[model samples]
Target: MKLLLLTAGSRGDVEPFAALARRAAASGHEVRLALPDRSGVDTTGIDARSLEADFSALIESQGVSPLAAMRSLRDVVRPVMRAVIVNAAQAALEFRPDVIAWHPKVLSAPLIADALGIPHVLVELVPVMTATREFPAAGTVTRSVGPLNRLTYRAAAGAGAMFRREVDEAAEVMGAPRSRRSSAPAATLLPISPAILPRPADWPESAVLTGAWRAREATTDAAAPTPDPALDAFLAAGPFAYAGFGSMAAGDPAARGRALVAAARARGIRLLVATGLGGIAVPDDARGDDVFVTRSVDHGVVLPRAVAAVHHGGIGTVQAATAAGTVSIVVPFIADQPFWGAMLHRRGLAPAPIPRRRVTADRLAEALAAAPAFQTAVEAAAARMADEDGAAEALGVLERLAGRPRNDALRHP
Candidate 1:
């Protein structure tokens, strides 16, 4: 089968689908990843295809409050939605995929697939997309209430559907019948494990959590893929913490580095920071034998050995830290990040979330030292996560629609 994956957003959003593409290719299917823009992504094995626009540029690279980002993001979709659908539809024509797998935010894919009369799957990276009384909004740590929990779902879904107007335009683009919201994709795949996030009873039968879409080799042996001699020396130096905040730039980065170093000093631990696309600045003036800051480090290799991990509370980082049995300290910046931080805390995997605005050297130092006794449960969570094969499960869903190697792959147990 030939599968075309459509996605946009930061690296976290694109990577799950890329992982899925690799898994599908391994099973003898032709896979190509279609990006709104593929800049800065290592497309080595991604079977990469470009839709030719960067979402970050559309969204903004500077500090926009979460509410402002949400408002502007929705507005951008309204004006540019037609062009995006047309461009992605054109790209799909070039790939001529048998199936289209898309991230939920990439609204154009489903519309284009419907216009082309092809099956498409929605790949949701976070639980926010699902409506359920079992949980409240994905942007907040709201406790479940009678109908309020479900209302949050409705609001999120309804707001997202505002972009569906482009489907009417899609009809003219493909010269096909107008698409209907009632006719959603054939399936929805969630790349998170129930061990970490239990499946909500309110979620439709079509949606399934297949664990985090980690590579088979990664689950089996994380450190083997990208060994780092400098990281090895740092780890050997003493117990250290992993601090990574990917692509979430704000505030004085130089000061941010000094604060983290101070935090590590407060806790009497070494610190290793991954200066990811987040624009974190760790000046040499603040660096010493105990503080090591690198622009890149294979998180898969380092998270496992660290005593604890502190990140910007991306869902991907949460999953990685949990699977490595390391405790977490979430300093949320925006969007559903606060939700993940709260969830991890509620689940006993971390302390209360520290909002990016409240992040200080003293606060982080205390958090690193005051972490709960969550090692046993987190270790258990890791074992359960390792047992799940998210990519294989998602592939099974696709094959069922394509009628290739089909079986009882949908049963959650």
Candidate 2:
């Protein structure tokens, strides 16, 4: 089967699709990945194409403030999203895939697939679709608002509706008439650990809760990691804490880094900080003999060695920390982050989340002090999730969807 996978956004959004692409290729399917330019996701052993947008650069250049985002929505965000849709449509024409799987950001995939008479799958990293009372939609309220939880998903749907014009434009560019069809995917594949957030009872049968998509070689019984000698020495020094804010550039990064360093120092432990996407800036004054700062390090190599990880609550980071059996201290910046933090806390995996605005040295130190209480639960959850192969599960779903007869004349209901 020929599979075309489309995704946009930062490394977190792109990496999961890369994992799925690799798995599909390994399973004897032809896979092509279309993602943002310079996404930096390792897509070895797969045919990867570049979409025109660069979500990472966009985030880094413009801080994630609601006001700034709204101000630039028309001028910047729309054009970028339009470019992604057009590029994805172009790739679909070239690949002529049997199945199309896409991240939510690529809203044009379903229309392209419909035009091509193939199946399309929605690959959600978070449970934003498929409304349920289990929890509020991710990126909305972190805690449930009783019966109102189901309403939160409407906001996610509205977000997609905002790009309806782009979707229609993409269809025309693909030389297919504008599809008035609902554009709902044939299948929804969620690459989230059921152990972290179980499948909600209200989800449709078309949705499958696959475990977290991870590279088999990276997490499986592969050879021991060979981190840099400095990092290796730091881990050997003593129990250190890990801090990183992936792809979030909301506030003063230098101050945030200083707070993290001070908090770790207050706990009398060493610190290893990653300045990912420049959202964290470890000031020179804060860098002591006990503090190590790097632009990048393998989370798989470092998190397991840390006593606890202090990070922005990206689902990827959340999954990484949990899989390493490392407790977490989530300082959420924005969008689905607080949701993950609150869920982890509810599951006995971490302390209560600290909103990024509320983060301080004292608060972080307190969370660090509280970390040990959750270690046993974190380890147990990690053990349970160990048996999961999210990529394989998602590939299976795509294959099944591909086997179904094509709907060449799909129309909106």
Candidate 3:
């Protein structure tokens, strides 16, 4: 079976699909990853395809300001949706995949799958539109809007409808009858464990809860030795806290960086800060001796050595920290982050979420100090997640959808 997997966004969003692609290939299926041109495809073992005129420019645009990008996405939802549809159509025409596996945000894949008369599987990293009262809204705050959270529900449904329409258009373009579009069967794969997000009542039967498919290897470069001897000394001292806002550092980054530095110092712990897309400047006082600041480093390598992990609570970051068996201090800013933070805390795997608005040196210090107690809980959760065969399970589902006859060779051997 030939599988076309589509994903977009930061490294976190693209990496999981890449991992899935690798697993599918290892399982004897031909897998290709279709991603935005700017996503920095490694293209070593898998077939990598790009869908942009200038990938670097696209990434640079997104990296300018995390908050701004989020706001822009909210404001121009239609245009963004259209761009996704166009990209997916182009990829589908050329690739002619037997099945389409797409990230939830890449709404166009389902439509293309319908047009091509193939199965479409939506991969959700977070429980955003998955219909659970588990966490807060993925967007900015809002006042109560009445029963069933109709406002939020409508927003979610509208987004779903928009994608549905795109899929219908793609079907027409691919010469499928209109009636088929209305009845097209869609399936979803939640790339998170049920332990993190319980199966919500509102979710349809088509959706399956699969544990996160994380790569066994770290994709980012290793942290280089700090130039300052004091910083080097700190690294040698003991396991310290790893802190950063994954990609939400653009809004007041200097202030946020300073606050993180102060919090780490207040707790008397050494820190390694990832600058993310928007670079976080290390405070002059915190820079020279004790702290190390880098643009990026593989969380898989660093999280295990850390006593605690403080982050913005993106799904990928949370999974990485949890898999490493490190306690978490989630400071969620926007999107599904708050939901992830709340879920981790409710599971007793991390301290309570510290919303970006409420994050301070004192608050962060307290969370860091409390993190050690959560270690036992984190290890248990990690063990449970490790037991799930996500990549294998996803492949099994994909093979069945492509109408391929299942045999022992596909599963094992």
| Top candidate when judged by TM-score against the true structure | 2
Candidate 3 Cα outliers beyond 4 Å, as residue runs: 53-81, 132-153, 160-185, 201-204, 216-237, 404-413
Which regions of candidate 2 fall more than 4 Å away from where they truly are?
220-223, 406-413
Two-way TM-score contest, 1 vs 2, winner: 2
lDDT comparing candidate 2 with the true structure: 0.86
lDDT of each: 0.74, 0.86, 0.69
As a whole number from 0 to 100, the lDDT of residue 49 in candidate 1 is 71
Provide the global lDDT of candidate 3 against the true structure.
0.69
Expressed as tens digits, the lDDT of each residue in 163-270 for candidate 2 is 888988898887777756645678789999987988888888888999999877775222345457877777777789999887778778888888898999999989
Q: By the TM-score metric, which is better: model 1 or model 3?
A: 1
Residues 1-413 of candidate 1: C-alpha lDDT, one tens digit per residue: 88888887777887777788888988899988877663345567768877656665554453435555567665563444445555667778787778788876666676566556667788888876667777777775545676677667555566555666665665566566665442466788889888778888768898988888876555424435546676677766667898888767776767778888899898888888987655367888888989887866666778888888889888888888898888899888776788888888788778888888777899998898876477777888889887788889999988877633212222210
Residue pairs with backbone atoms closer than 3 Å in model 2 (clashes): none
lDDT digits (tens) for residues 28-71 of candidate 3: 88888877655544558779876443323443455444455556
In order of appearance, the predictions have TM-scores of 0.88, 0.96, 0.82
Alpha carbon lDDT of residue 202, candidate 3?
56
Number of clashes found in candidate 1: 2
Indicate which candidate wins on lDDT.
2
